[model samples]
Target: MPATFIRRIASPKKAVTGLAVAAATAGMALTAAPAHAATTSSAADAKAIAKQMIPDSAQYNAFSKIVQHESGWDVDATNPSSGAYGLVQALPGSKMASAGSDWKTNAKTQIEWGLNYMNDRYGSPAGAWDFWQANGWY
Candidate 1:
């Protein structure tokens, strides 16, 4: 099997990244309510976006763990070595173009691609979570 396919199939991190890409393709818009007129995103902000992309309640906890481990919820998180970027860490960061051109900084695109990947390969978040448990990298 191809490494990319295996990577997409096994990794929760990759699954979340796939969800972001799907969100971008679907043109998911994120709105912020200001606590004091300065728009800010909290953990809830990430969770809200995540819930929209991933509707399965069982998948939520597993997905959140991967996001926290990979990027700590920072939308602009980047890996210099592989050039992965965004909340879910898109490798080369540009493969997200499969979803949209805004893949670089748009959290939606990354999440979309990730969710699509998880659904396609493992069938559900629980399946992805099981794979993750067996493989540390996932």
Candidate 2:
């Protein structure tokens, strides 16, 4: 396998200095709510978006762990060296374009794309989790 693939398998959660940040500008539109409430971070938003997709607690837990390790729940988390992007660290990130056009801004898009990848590549989230545990990545 190529070194980038090996590195992804060995350290899939690699972090970079220039992570894209979700703008909180939308919160500015909330006239009644506190600015802080409107300022929900992408990490929290990603977790909420993920739970909506997984729904089941057991599956969500496993998925959550993998995503946490891979991204610290940051939808914008990226691997500078490998160029993997988003919550589950999809390499090239553009591959997620299959899931939706909003892949860059919407955590739901990334989550759905990631779930599809785990399903297609490893049979299921549990299977991906197992592979990640054994190999240090998924």
Scored by CA lDDT, what does every candidate get? 0.67, 0.76
Please provide, for model 1 over 99-128, each residue's C-alpha lDDT reduced to its tens digit, 9 standing for 90 to 100: 766665556666777666666778865676
TM-score of each: 0.61, 0.68
lDDT of 2 at 47: 85
lDDT, candidate 2, residue 130? 89
Instruction: Please list the residue runs of candidate 1 whose C-alpha ends up more than 4 Å from where it truly belongs after superposition.
Output: 1-43
CA shift at 109, candidate 2, in angstroms?
0.1
Top candidate (TM-score): 2
Model 2 misplaced stretches (Cα beyond 4 Å): 1-40
For candidate 1, the lDDT comes to: 0.67
TM-score of 1: 0.61
Lowest lDDT sum, 10 consecutive residues, model 2, at 15-24
